[model samples]
Target: MTRLERKCPICGKPRAAEHTPFCSKRCRDRDLLQWLEDGYALPGPPSFPDNPQDD
Candidate 1:
């Protein structure tokens, strides 16, 4: 049986067992940074301010 190869989401390189979905620490860290900096986001309705005065 042939096993399917998984590639890194960030660089398209073959994934490592240590990184799982990423090729290396750098790629993993980059993915984390993207989430931290809002480079990626989930689809959702616009949020409204709890305090109308703030708007």
Candidate 2:
């Protein structure tokens, strides 16, 4: 199948045109909530405001 017709990334169901990558609003909102809650994280050095190196 074409890339556009791939299954939903959230539930592995057939994707809807409206949601594009997700099957429905439920999955779409779920993904949004994950981002809002910081469910995804990127690797980075720990940042601290107390560092005194700033001049």
TM-score for candidate 1, please give it: 0.77
lDDT of 1 at 37: 100
Clashes of each: 0, 0
Query: Which lDDT tens digits does candidate 2 get at residues 11-54?
Result: 99999998888999999999999999999877886565566677
Clashing pairs in 2: none
lDDT digits (tens) for residues 19-50 of candidate 1: 87799999999999999999998898657767
Predicted structure 2, TM vs. truth: 0.72
Q: Any runs in candidate 2 off by more than 4 Å, and if so which?
A: 45-55
- Model 2 Cα RMSD, 1 decimal: 2.7
lDDT of 1 at 30: 99
| Candidate number with greatest lDDT | 2
